[model samples]
Every structure is written in C-alpha cells, then in structure tokens.
Target: MVELNVLVADLRAESAEIDALVGGLSADDWATPTPAAGWTVAHQVAHLAWTDRQALLAINDEAAFRAELAAITVPPERMDELVDAAAAEGAAQPPAELLAGWRRGRDDLAEILERAPDDTKLPWYGPPMSAASMVTARLMETWAHGYDIADALGVLREPTARLRHVAHIAVRTRDFAYLVRGEQPPAEQFRVELTGPDGEVWTWGPADADQRVTGPALDLCLLATQRINRADTALVTAGPDADAWLDIAQAFAGPPGDGRDAGSRERERRTPA
Candidate 1:
C-alpha cells in the first residue's frame, strides 16, 4: 500500500493545480467544451464536486451511501445518460459558485482522507477500497478531469511525479478492468515498466515476468485515463494479456469506458487528406 500521507499530499497538489486552472476562467471559458464529447469545463468540475460530496457521504455515513446507491434507476446501458443528467444539474449554477462549491468539496475530502485509518475499508461505487486506494482514486479522477480542462483551454500541464500515483492505480486496477468487461483476468501478473517524469524507472510485477509493458509514465497515465486511444500511444506491449490490457485499461471504477476515438491526426496519417 502507498503511504497515505504521500497520496494525500499529491491529491492536494493535484486539486490546487486544477483550482488554478479554473480560478480565472470567464463564464464563456467555463462553458467551453472539452475533449470529452459533449462535456463542457463546467460539467467536468461539477462532476468532480458531486463525486467529492459522494465520497464524503460514504465516509461519514455508509448507510446514506447505500441508500443513495440503491435509488439509482438507470440501467447499465444508460450510465452515460445518468452522468450527463447529473453534470447538467450540477453545472446549472453560476461559474463562480461552481468553482467555490468544488473547492469546498475538495478540501472536505482531503481533510477526511488525511485522518482516515490506513487499513480502513470504505464502500465506494465499486468494491470496497482502502483509504489509500480511495485517495488514489480521487487523485486519478482529479488528474484525468484536469487534463480535459487543460486541453480545452489550450494549456499544457507539465507532467509531474504525481503521475506515479495515477500509474500505480492504473496498474493496480488491471484486474478490475478485466472484471468489468466480464472477462476472466489472466492468472499471471504481467510486468509494467514506465519511465517517470524525472527519469526514474517504475516497475510493477516480477522482474522476470514473460509479459511486459514498457512506456513513458505520462502515456501510461493517459492510456489509463482513456484520454488517449491505446492505438495512438507510444507504449510497447510484449505479451498476450499485456496487449489486451492496454486496449481496455481503465483506472476509474465504472462500467467499461467508451475509449477515445483515435485522433484525427492518426486517422489522417492512415488516409490521404
């Protein structure tokens, strides 16, 4: 398990970075659509705020969380519709109000996570997760949504060591990815090797594992977030399960995501434009 303090620190930094990104945006900017199809910047921030509130509920009142979960009427096939409705309702507020709401929710979550017991299991939308895993999930969602916001606003966020947290979750969730797809996970663990932002090498799985993935940490994080299509990344996979895992790698807990379309640039290269 990752040190909870380190994970919380990273989550704080990630939250701060996102705050800075949206802190000065105009109403028009907040309304701008991001790379996520049909989701504007406000929608992304609103979703984060809503989830933070949900996390708070789960921590403070598990019975309430269970009740909330049980009230869901949308079937699995319409999950995106459920998300769209939630985002729209949440984003209906003024831009300043939205930002403030998100900030308050984020701070509340950070404070709770800081004091949570290391081994405590918290019920989430998916399976129960440890406090550290909960914080990491928050970090991954923040970073992923932050990426969408940055891209929409034409800002380039420098890759940070924080990506290691996202990468770690991505690797840890490999089995979840398989489970969500209703496929049996490989009984064997495949090696994951990534070059971190500072050029430090991060390795998971056994050193002598026959299956392996090698790539830049940023690419791995993006792939895990589904921000980039697996077909477009520079990652190299050298095993049967490794290749399949890359195609469906999702760190977020949910139904299998609709992965990104291979960008127009990739499509153009394959055709004469």
Candidate 2:
C-alpha cells in the first residue's frame, strides 16, 4: 500500500520550501525570466498556482474540472501554447497576491489529499491517478519549477534525498514516455540506479536486467522533469530502450516537452540574448 500521508507531508514541505525562496524576492526579482522561454518568474509561480487549483478541482469535483478543461478548446498539439497564454493572464497579479494564491492552493491541496480515501483515484489532465501518485506528481512539479526560479535568481539549491520520490515516479512512468510519443512501449523493464544526495544508492528494477540507467539522483530527477537536457547530464544508459527513454522520459502528464539543451551551451546563448 502507498503511504499517501507521507507523500502529502512531502508535498507540503516542498511547497513551503519554494514559498520561502520566493517570499523574500523583490518585485523586480519576481519579474525575471526563467529558462523556460517566454515565462517570467511570476509566470512560473502563476502556472504552479493555477495547476494546483485544477488539481483541487480534479480531486473534489471531477465533472466540473472535466467541463472546465473541455471549455478551454485547445487542441492536443497546441496545449503548450494555450498554457503559456493562460499563464500570462494568471501572472497579471502582483507578487504578493500571486504568492498568497499559491499558498492557499497548496495548503488546500495538502489537506484534501491527506483526508482522501487511500484507494480513490483522482481525475487529472491525463489518466486518473491514485491519491499517492497525485501527491507525488505535485511534489515533482514543485521541485522542478523551484529549480527554474532558483536558476533565474542565480541560486543553487542544495539537493535532497526527497528526490527519491521523483526518481521513483520517473522510473515507474517509463512506458508513459513512449506512449505519449505515439510509439509502442518496449516490453522490458530497465534497471535504474541513482546515487542519492548523501551517497546512498537508490535503485529500481531487477538486479540482472540487461538494460540499465545509472546516474546522480538529482540528475535523474532533473532529466525526468526536463529541467536539464538528457545530453547535458552524465546519466549512463546501456540498452536499446534506455537511451530512447532518456529522449522522452517525462514524469509529468502532458504532451511531449521540448527539453532544455546542454547546460553550459544553453546558458551562454540565452544569457546575453
């Protein structure tokens, strides 16, 4: 059984950490653009807050949430464009109001997930997810977007063992990656082994599996979240599906993402633009 309460606690803690980071930023700082093209820091936070509200609706009122999604009228191929436009609208609020809205949504989400029945599935943009998976997905998004804010502010966050949750979801979603690309999922389970922040080995899949991916846990999480391009990281892959999976390993639900380019090269190109 999934320890959903634990996941909820982690989700709450992740949101709190991000809240602390953004809380001290000046209005000017909040206007800084992140690596995500055309999205400012305010846009990042606004997206998180908006998604949180959607998640709450999914949990509490599935029919209403689905109706709302249907009303948006964006085609599958243009979902990202729609999100950017929606985020711009959501980002119109002042920093304080944005932060408050984010905190309110985060707190409400944690509370609802905590009280939810363990076996119940929550509706989402993609397939419905269990309470555990839902909270974990929220935690994953918190960490990923938090990275964008930190990078935009030129602050490097201390990596944490909490990344284990993300890595777990990333490994479990291997097949989803292929399916999202309209490709058939390989009928093989590849081993994944990552060294945690504290030098502990965290692993998934069979010990003797022919296919394996091994890397720093943080790199794996960043790769899964598409924060860092697969080519930029020292992640090792040794199988047919392993490399292909890296090309499309997305932990979150949505259409496929255009991941970042190599780290240093991307920075050089974008910093002066």
Candidate 3:
C-alpha cells in the first residue's frame, strides 16, 4: 500500500496542474461551457472548491459536517439538484474570486490531510474513507474535472504517470459502481491489465481470471470517469461480466452519469464551419 504522505504529495501536484490551467483565463473563458451539460469552466472550478470545503468540514469538524448534511432536505432522487445549485452559486462569483477560493480550499484540505492520523476515516457522500483514500478520491476528481475544462478550451493535456491513481480507484470502485446503479457486482474476480503512459503495466485481480479487461491506462481512466465514450476507447474485454462493467463503469460518487456520446467529439471535429 502507498503511504499517506506520498498520496498527499500527488494530490497537491494534481491540484496545482489544474490550478495553472485556470489561473490566467480571461473572464470570457470562465463562462465557456464544458462537456458536462450546463456546466461552464467556472462551474467546474467552483464545484471543486465547494467539494474541497466539504472535505475540510468532514476532516476537521464532524458535528458541523453532520449539521450541514442534516440541513439538506432534498429527496434522494433530487440530490443532484443540490449539487448543481452549489456549483451555480459558486460559479456566479467573479473569475478572480472563484480562482482564489479554489486555491485556498484545496490547499487547506491538503495541509489538514497531511497532519491527519494514518488511520483517520473521513465521512463522505459515499462510504467513509481513510485519509489516503480521501486524497486519492480528490486527485481523481481534480483530473476528471480538469479534463472537462481542457476539453472546453480545446486543449489536450498530455497523459502522465499520475493517471495511475485514477486507474487504481476506478478498479477498486468496481463494486461501488454497480451498487450505486441498483445492481449486484459479479461474484467472480476480473483481471485488469493496463499499459501506463510510460509503458508500465498495472495489474489487478488474479491473472488467470476468466474475466479480463486490457487496454491503455489513459483510456481506462477516461472510460471509468465517463469522460470518454467506450466506443472511442481502445479497451478490450473478455467475458460477459467484463463487457458489462465497461458500459456502466463510473469512479465517482452520486447518480449514474449520462456518459459522453460515442462519436460526439469526432463529429465536433469534423463539422464544417
């Protein structure tokens, strides 16, 4: 298992990368819509800032966090409305203000996590997570949302080794993915073998398992996060369970996402002006 400090460092790095992307954007750029329907670049950063604050509350003040949770009176089905409401509220701030708030919140969360006990468990919308696990989750979100912002700007970010964290979480959350969708995961274990950015192979599960997923690590991470449609990825799967999981795979918490259309990006690229 990776140590807490190492994960913390990676989280900081991931946040910094996204920070650099938005730090100098013009006000108009902030209003540009991202791939996530109805969300602008401002909405992406605002959501990150808002979520960072929630993490801080969970880590530093349990009672306050519980109170905040209790204040939410929305029905379970409409929880997404609450999330969108928060993002919209935050996105309304001036671009400079939004950027500053995001920087502060993410930095504070990282500092607190660094000092937290190794066995510390933090309350989250999903299951309680260890400090390390929490940092990993944050890194995954930072990268995924960052992708949305980049896509909106027509910028292509080079894949890096940091993607390993995203891939690991996607694999570990396989069961959660199914559970959130009101289905039981297959009992049998499936092997996952992915080629990383630098050609390193990351593997999980029994090698001889009948169910297997094999592909580039970047594609798997993008697929798991629902950033790229499965049809646009190079992932190859064997066995019925493996094939099915790819269709519905999601690494993040909350409602099942309406993933990107298979050829939407391609169509966008090929359309005549």
Candidate 4:
C-alpha cells in the first residue's frame, strides 16, 4: 500500500497541474465546450471544486456529509442530476471567482487529507474509502477533468507516472463498473498490462489469468475515465469478458457514462481548409 503522505502529495501535484491550465484563461475561454456533452471548461473546473468541497465535508464533518447526502431526495437513478446541478451552479459564477474557489477548496482538502489518519474511512457517493483511497480518487478526477479542460483548450498533455493511480483505481473498480450498470462481473479476474510513458509496465490481476487487457497506459486511463472511446484507443483484449469490460469501464462513481463517441478525437484534430 502506498503511504498516505505520498498519495496526498501526488493529489496536490495533480490539482496544481490543472490549476495552471486554467489560471490564464480568458472569460470567453471558460465557456468553451469540452467533449462532455453540455459541459464547458467552466463546468469542468466547477465540478472539481464542488467535489472537493464534498470531500472536505466527508473528512472534517461526517455528520454534515451524511445530512447533505440524506437531504438529496433524488432517486438513485437520477443522482447525476444533482451532480450536473451543482456544476451548473458553480459555473454560473464569474470565472475569476470560480477559479479562486477551486484553488482554495483543493488546497484546503489536501491539508485535511495530509493530517487524516491512515485508517480513516471517508464516506463517499459510492463505497467508504480509506484516506489514501480518497486521495487517489481525487487525483483520478483531477486528471480526468483536466483532460476535458485541455481538450477544450486544444492542448495535449503528456502522460506521466501519475496515471498509475488512475489505472489502479480503474482496475480495482471493475466490479463496481458492472454492478452500477446492473450487470455481474465475470467470476474470473482479468490481467491488465499497460505500458507507461516511461516504458515501465504497470500491471494488475493474476499473471496467469486467461482474460487480459494490454495497451498503452494513457489509452487505458482515458478509456477507464471515459474520456476516450474504446474504438479511439489502442487497447487490446484477449478474451470476450475482457473486451466487454473495456466497453463499460469507468473509474469514477455514480451512473454509467455515455463515453466519447468513436472518432471524436480524430474529428477534433482535423484541420479544415
């Protein structure tokens, strides 16, 4: 298991990376739409900021978090509506205000996590998570939403070792992915082997597992985060179950996502005369 401090440090770094990306954006730039259907750059940042606030509540005041959760009267199936509503409310703020809130919220969350006990279990939308696991989840969201912001800005970010955290959560949530979709995961475990940016192989599951997914680490991370469609990735699968898993993989909690459409990246990259 990774030390809690290390995970918190990585989470801080990941948040900083996204902060730099939006720190200089013009107000107009904040309105630029990203690949997430109706979400703009502002919406992406707002979502991250809102989620950070939720994380703080979970950590510093569990009763408040529970009360907040209980106050939500939406049916489980429509829970995403609340998520979208929160982002919309935050995005409605002035860009400078939104950015400042995000900065303050994330920084405060990081400080709280750093002081949290290693065995601390935080309540979340999904399952309760250890302090380390919560930080990992936050890092995963920062990277995933940062991709949306980068895409909206027409910038390409180089993959880094931080992706290992995202990929690890994705692999660990394989069963959760299926469960959320009203499906049962295969009883057999699937081996996932990814080639990282530094050429290191990051792997999970039994070495002798018949079901296997092999691909560039970036592709797996993007696919798991639903930032890229399976057809747009170089991921390879050796078993029927493995192939099926790739189609519905998601690293985040909540309802199943409608992943990016095939060829969306190609379309975005096209230079029209």
How big is the RMSD of model 2? 3.2
Model 4: ten consecutive residues of lowest lDDT: 264-273
Pitting candidate 2 against candidate 4, the one with the higher TM-score is 4
Give the runs in model 2 whose Cα sits over 4 Å from its true position. Answer: 264-273
TM-score of each: 0.94, 0.94, 0.95, 0.96
**Model 3, poorest ten-residue lDDT window?**
264-273
Candidate 3 off by > 4 Å: 264-273
The top-ranked prediction according to TM-score is 4
C-alpha RMSD of candidate 4: 2.4
Local distance difference test scores for all models: 0.88, 0.86, 0.90, 0.90
| Residue range 130-240, candidate 3, lDDT tens digits | 998999999999999998887888777777888999999999989988998889999999999999989999999999999999999989899999999999989999999
- The parts of candidate 4 lying over 4 Å away from their true place are 267-273
Residue pairs in candidate 3 whose N, alpha carbon or C atoms collide under 3 angstroms: none
Residue 131, candidate 3: C-alpha displacement in angstroms: 0.2
Clashing pairs in 1: none
